[model samples]
Target: MGHAADRRPGTRVDRMMTVPAAVSRSDRASATREAILNAAERLFAEEGLFAVSNRRVSEAAGQGNNAAVGYHFGTKTDLVRAIAHRHNGPIERTRARMVAEVGETDDTRAWLACMVRPVTDHLADLGRPTWFARFSVQAMADPGYHRLMAEESLSSSSLRRALHGLQASTPHLTREVGEERREMFRHLVLNVCAVRERELAEGEPTRWPTWDDTATGLIDALYGLMTAPMTPIGTIRR
Candidate 1:
């Protein structure tokens, strides 16, 4: 049914050749997979997603076998999903904890802080030279793979609760308005973080002193955007 399933179950490229008792072989295979993921993520961030191929990812990952990415992950979309999965669990857990602390608040800033901090915190937890934020921006720039990030890990219970809390802060927001604002919010958070991540990676100074401070700035901006006065003036007169 799935893309990988469309191929035969035990193809040479897809199968592991090592014996079962060789736990070290399993360890090496895992390390190879992680290398491929890291290289693919960096390539997807620096270059465009579709611009780079599985072979290129393999080479960048230092895999002698060009089919390494394919063998490990099936398709390009599957690789993207894998990358998102790496980041999503920690992000969701961080958000869930923050949400618990901020419970049932009607404040837009509180909700916005909930939305922004989890991502910043995750990146902070990763230390220097992280690629995920840039990788995320590029992924979202493409229409075909943009939704993978959400479906893979971002659409969690905590995310839904955060959005609902935001919505509660703006009772009169129409569905269309909410959709438009969500798009804007997504662009702001992803791009800003990408810029900051890039700067941090390059040893350049950030506008804010820390990731938490950057998150605080984003919280302010998001709160303003979500609560801004919407207007088209009076209705069109006939």
Candidate 2:
């Protein structure tokens, strides 16, 4: 009985010792993964979709060999997908929260900020606005990335639901035209913001305008144009 008891302690110690080593390995792997993602984000943003290679990502990540990208993520597509996925979660959650917060407000201004704040704040938090911003523009322009974005982003049903909720919350937007136009205007805002981001990163003179100005201008113009009664196109010859 004593012999068995003595062996029990040794067995427990063996198990306990293995855990920290396993945990340490896991921590190392996690750190490596973050490094790889950070490097990939920069390269993809600066160079565009096709410009960045798996080998370059690995090298920039400080990994020892080409196997790292494959070993960790299996493929270039998978790695970029992972990076996008990682950012997408927080973004979606923030948007959802803002949507909910605006639920009680009757003002469309509050609702408008709810829809746009998440995006602007996300870019602000990234600190390297150029990285995610450029990637976003590329995604918007590239059919492949657009499909990927649609897949990862809120589903159509979810978007409609959110829009319906927003319409319900904002009493000023009663007509179908108002609601539909608002949604289209929101998309326009996203498009303009993406273009501005790309221009800023390309070292072009952004002194022509600011992102916020462009954003607000787009939203205002859209709101006015969509809400205003339509005039006959050819009749407005003046």
Candidate 3:
């Protein structure tokens, strides 16, 4: 009774009338931007990134305006970076919580899992027919876009904390070896995810049945690589 008494007559119509045309324009712009992003991601992943052009992305996105990608996202590098940011938000949130739970453990696998699970969980949540992992592999292959992805990835505070925790546990790990193994870890995780995604996309049977299992396999491999004794690279014995 009190709720009804407080409600003004024709309030809904008045509220609708109050919204400016600018709001609708903004919504349309945002929707167009998202469509462009989705189109670019799928094209880049499926057709090999270099083969696809901005005009292709515009056409695929259903934009009559050929300049949509540039207008919305600036350069191609920026477009790639924007896609990375879009996906990393939720992945970082889950990683932040996982890092808090693990909290400076001696367990190398735990630290790796802190880094690994959030990504797998995010992919799982996105379900089948995902392209971001493959898109990432494509980005990493290109020197220009690799820098963009690398810069965007390093911006995550949660990821930094997780890597720091891993670093703390690895006392015997030298700087050069750490850098080497870190690159290995990166390729292993990302390429494996890319391969699995490709398998799913192509209807080929994958060795692992689920993202969880794939993550576990990576954790094991990464844990082994991270813990393995470093072989000093003197000049190659030729």
| Per-prediction backbone clash count | 0, 0, 0
Order of the predicted models by lDDT, top scorer first: 3, 1, 2
Which residue pairs of candidate 3 clash? none
Clashing pairs in 1: none
User: What is the C-alpha lDDT profile of model 1 across 1-238, one tens digit per residue?
Assistant: 5465323446653354434536787888899999999999999999979799999999999999999999999999999989998898998898899899998778888888888999999999999899999999999888888778767644689999998898888876787888789889989999999999999999998899899999998888888888886775486845
Query: What are the per-residue Cα lDDT tens digits for candidate 3 across 1-238?
Result: 3444323545875556546656888999999999999999999988867888998999999999898889999988788888889999999999999988987588888899988999989999997899999999999988768878888888999999888888877878998788888988988999999999989888999989999999999999998999988666785655
lDDT of each: 0.88, 0.68, 0.88
What's model 3's TM-score? 0.89
Question: Model 2 clash tally?
Answer: 0
Window of ten residues with lowest summed lDDT in model 2: 1-10
lDDT of 3: 0.88
- Writing each residue's lDDT as its tens digit, candidate 2 over 158-236 gives 3454556556655555476565677576567666666667676676765336555654666566546444664444675
True-structure RMSD, every candidate = 9.2, 5.1, 5.3
